[model samples]
Target: MPFDFSQSHFVLFGLPTTFALDRAVLDTAYRKLQAEFHPDRFAAADDAQKRLSLQIATRVNEAYQTLKSPLARARYLLQLNGVDTQEDTNTAMPVDFLMQQMEWRETIADAKTQRNVDELEELNRQLAEEITELTVELAELLDEQHAWSDAATAVRKLRFLEKLNDEIGNAIEAVLF
Candidate 1:
């Protein structure tokens, strides 16, 4: 079949529509698609064919990226289920989660102020654990339970944890530097 831009990313990659995916399968499929539609392969083709190849290649890359990240994959599944996470518009997280987030921020700020590499590393470990736990919860919600609303909440929490993880890495760099 010809390439179809309108198809879902999972459909494009011949993957099942779920949050849990095999990384090896995704990598193989992405590489196969890249080899098939890479713009370099179209150098000798007509201008229209080259343009089409470029477009298909771009779409393939976008799909690969979206499917590769756990958070992105969860969000895409939620969107497909008609659940708009709406990060900006829907900011109503549980009160306990909000408090925990504040605590993490304060801990980050304190670690930065003290220039404590060990403490930063500890925080990074903690965040990594939380990310792992949430990822499991997300998979259960999205794949087994089909709990779209809970999955949306899980996606938002994962986003926050990811941002915090990045900040912790930056703090570690600053301390080491």
Candidate 2:
């Protein structure tokens, strides 16, 4: 309940305002904040206290979720710097990336139709590697270079990859069962 709602999520978690964060540190901070602001702790208090506690708990949970996710953290950092990703309206991606996306979708469809778990798993590994590489690049662009525009592009690409990754996961599940 000592939390200031106006503070940025990074400050709320006692973290630097950067895209790259230590998950362990975030997890620890989240646990501590949750323990302090948990609604049950204020159950015996007055209604106002309980309401405030619930609000703080909700904010803490939201901050924890945002920081824990790489893509979300990147987007949040961009927002903090007054850079809008414009994900909805700005859909112009590089041609190579669009081609790569098409290829990935084709591969996924084929793997799913054949129910090829091994193939799907291989595709998953490849996609994961690409994601990792992009994440590293994104960290450098946002934290080191301060290239907000490039970072926004990287975020858009990551968003596409994340969606495809979800589809791949579903395809794997369908193939399994």
Candidate 3:
């Protein structure tokens, strides 16, 4: 396929190395790369070429996945800037954020226990809004201000919000079924 295998994910997809990306552009590039390097297209080629095609296809898929998810993209951006998120080693969060998390969890537990679908839905809405806000802040931190440490902290918070959102989804399913 004449593609550089060692390129970063964003470079592979011809994307600018920024937190704020256009989804439509990413989607188009992903599809174009997949079509260009699809292994099936190399079915008639020599074994060596076929293997290369397979590797290329695998890399393409991996890059697409990393670029598509906001959490993954944020982490990748931080990594590109030589900033380790330290998500595991740095578990210490602000007390106010911790308190807010506890409150949300308590609300979730109560609503789930009571099978209150409406409350669960409302909480889900609020969580979505918070996620959106954090994402915007991350875009500014990573793209505009180049605040790597602040971006890393924001990424950690985003991960927590995503996990909590998943829990809310599970609770909604439990209450429904």
On TM-score, the leading prediction is 2
Residue 115 in candidate 1, Cα distance off native in Å: 0.9
lDDT of 3 at 158: 93
lDDT of 3 by residue, 1-177 (tens): 587887899999888999899999999999998999999999999999999999999999998899999999999999988999999899778899889899999999999999999999999999999999999999999999999999999999999999999999999999999
lDDT, candidate 2, 89-169, per-residue tens: 898999999999999999999999999989989989999999999999999999899999999999999999999999999
Each candidate structure's TM-score, on Cα atoms with residue i matched to residue i, is 0.96, 0.98, 0.97
Sort every candidate by TM-score, greatest first.
2, 3, 1
Candidate 3 clash pair list: none
Which runs of model 3 end up more than 4 angstroms from their true locations?
none
Q: Which stretches of candidate 2 lie over 4 Å from their true place?
A: none
Model 2 TM-score on a 0 to 1 scale: 0.98
Query: What are the per-residue Cα lDDT tens digits for candidate 1 across 1-177?
Result: 278889999998899998889999999999999999999999999999999999999999999999999988988888888999877778788999889989988998898899988888998898899999999999999999998888888888899889989999988888889
Listed per model in order, the count of residue pairs whose N, CA or C atoms clash below 3 Å is: 0, 0, 0
Please report the candidate that would top lDDT against the real structure.
Answer: 2
Model 1 error, position 117 (Å): 0.6
